[model samples]
Target: MNRRVSELGERGLIRRLREKFPSLHSIGDDCAVLPGIRCPVVTTDSFFEGTHFHRWWAPPQILGRRLLEAALSDIAAMGATAKWFFTALSVDPGIGVNWIEGFYQGLTEREDVILAGGETVRGERLGITLTVIGEGEDRDTILRRSSLHPGDNLWITGLLGRALDAPAKLEKAGGLSGKDLKPRSGFLSSAELEQLRAFLQPRAELELGIKLRKAGIRCAIDISDGLFSEASHLSLESSVDTVLEIDETLFFDSVKDNPLAASAAGEDYVLLFGAPVGLEFSSVGCSKIGRAETGNGEMTIFLDGERVSINAKGYDHLGVRK
Candidate 1:
């Protein structure tokens, strides 16, 4: 027997969903809720085979874990606790049954979160879409992109440029980018190994987000794009001039000299938040890197007291000078 949407209708469909997926609370409301969550925080992301990621980049399980990590970063940015996630996959059977099983196994690595029901279908190429839901204490506890204000200090978690390192090397090895300059070596330094691990498996700042929410941080963003792009976004969002006064200490040892590369390389997945000037967060491993200034949606970068110039991502959309 087969079922049709017209037969069940909307209410009936919701009732079925509630019955089948008992983990979700308060289904059929304007917004569904998770158990014990006060406010719902929802975020969605789409990943395709070639454009966003390449299957050959990592093992199926590692790739699946990384995808979940990337999407969870959004929930972390909202200062919320992720409780559930629904994943939709478009896979070709040629991709193999073991690969699919391994992928799902990887997604279930976190016991705290439940994998809600989702749909899967055959497609020409692989595509994965994830919808993650988290919770905050209340409406006021959720962070906002527009809450950063002038005179607030900008803080970032973890080293920058490491996330882009592994992918760039992988692309070069796959001959997508430029040719690899040097041959692969068996001996790898601890730092070099760390960079590769950072990309293959990145961890979202989940506990940090909860702490930031408890600490009353009103505005924050995860560094998914590049530092430059994220800073421009925050500026446009808050309608303030974002100024990054950076030093080599703010970056990984590899790209410290290249300010433009360090600033533009994305996918760090670290938290960047604005706190009141003079406020310190030394205990939480956060570095005070910049400040939000009074202006209209412009971003400025200063390296060692000298201002550098470059065309940046979302720079034109913000309608600002170089």
Candidate 2:
């Protein structure tokens, strides 16, 4: 009998999963791709039990699906279509074959992802890391923090605060996959869970982004960090100040008291873009909540003419407080 896997170190754990996949491409590059398309864009992310998601709130399936979504979102942020992915996992004795099977089931349901390789081990906690590979041309890959220009309007997609405030609503709305269960974190109420279910899912807006890019839309950022932090990055990068107008109607109808918090909250998986005022976009509806102005000081966030401060407090792995 294989004496429990707990003895394996991190490198040993990774080697086990690596052996499963045949070496196809070099890992020296940031990302790897097959012959489907040219000019690949690569991004990676890591999700763990306490850091990314709570084991009690979501099932193994939703956890697995979201893992792929988090990595793919980075690819989509660059306006690229995800072609393939590689994954690595770490776990403790509590995990079993059934749990891993369900995790893959959730991943497969989200998209046809081909696993390059991965591994398993016995440890004190469970964690998952994924690297996604995508393909796109120069214009379609979008710009990073340094690319935003002056005189651009800031826009955000979808509703906010719906994910962190209301987990029960999402559960009801089918936001979560596999068998339904009560939220382990106790952060979401029954109504909120239903609403969140309708909202949070593994979504890619690559199609919409490409269309906008072709239409001459330039500066953009994915709302991975709270909109407040992301906007700050844009402003700092472009050397501009931002003004955000709170649209009560645009927020999840249930949490209206502090809509900015929802907007400032993370994990909405929405895309934020900066472009010349009045450029038209198709598919997803965008809200023009702010404007950018040339400035000499640190980036500032304004809500209804008042300065609001927000840290990049969205789902940090070693940083989030349990």
Candidate 3:
């Protein structure tokens, strides 16, 4: 009889995988640590053509950029400077050569990032896996999700739901035809273009994370999954309860009238931190949403003084789709 992976859940699956191949250190942390030599941090991320993204949404170049950014976001969460990357690509033979070249061009365009090495293989669908290596400014100052403390205020950087809105915006512009997929800037209105850009080429909050580390803030996690899910992970890891008190006006201004959508939207790739006091970053907005308390990982959300029910769910590989 075959067992369903969904029955295990992500954490359980991870635990099982770790048990099968035990390592010297814990496996749940964001980056694998290699002792000595400036606390080097390493993280890997994978993107599948069908499950994670589609060609109809973004061109190959943009897709490659997004894949690399996703891996970099993990380095940012650890408050580290990304130094190099390795990519493994699984491509269908039918994919055009120009698309592959454009993907590499977009990925290598970053100023400080260097592509160390990678491999390519034939597959039925497109897949990209990126491994990012980074070094902390100071070994002692590396941040972790497990460092969150009781009474620490929770904060998030940048607007949410923009990535989630891109598909709808594309459909509204004219569905996912070939021309629509490879949309020109001149063809889209400013708002449509902005939304599409947000989805296709989201940036990692590396600088803000470095600043936060320098300012002595400790606990942080990047929002690759939804805000609610990532916040809940922090609470669980820190062994605390989190109460998310969202400011309706500010949230609406950022996300435009969909608080629930903002909470559940994934691929934002923004940094969310737990600090004792609010810290400011120029050109990036941060909002204090709630605080941590001593508890068994319970989380609550409040909107305008009324207790609102929020689904603390995000993208899960084995999770059932709605």
- Per lDDT, the best of the predicted structures is 1
Question: How many clashes in each structure?
Answer: 1, 14, 0
Any runs in candidate 2 off by more than 4 Å, and if so which? 1-33, 139-141, 166-191, 198-202, 297-322
- How would you encode candidate 1's per-residue C-alpha lDDT over 205-263 as one tens digit per residue? 99899898888899999999988888888899999998898888877765666656766
Clashing pairs for model 1 are: 225-266
Give lDDT tens digits, candidate 2, residues 1-322: 3433444444554454344334412253445545666777888788887667755445667667767776777776676667777766677765554465556656656445566444454557888778777776674446566556667776776666655554444444443434654443335555565555544454656666666566666667777777777877777777777666556765766676666667766776767777786674435687777777777425554555455555555322232222
Per-residue lDDT tens digits of candidate 3, residues 1-322? 3333344443443354344323311444554444354768899888888788777665666777778888899999999988878777776666665566566766776877767555566678878898888899776798898888888888888766666566666665543334234453325566556656676778998888898898898899998888888998999998899998765443424355566666777788988899885455434588777899989888777765556665436222221232
Candidate 2: C-alpha lDDT: 0.62
- Candidate 1 RMSD to the real structure: 7.9
Q: Write the candidate numbers in order of decreasing TM-score.
A: 1, 3, 2
TM-score of 1: 0.80
Candidate 2 differs from the real structure by a C-alpha RMSD in angstroms, to one decimal, of 7.4
Better of 1 and 2 by lDDT: 1
Q: What are the RMSD figures for all models against the true structure?
A: 7.9, 7.4, 11.6
lDDT of 1 at 244: 91
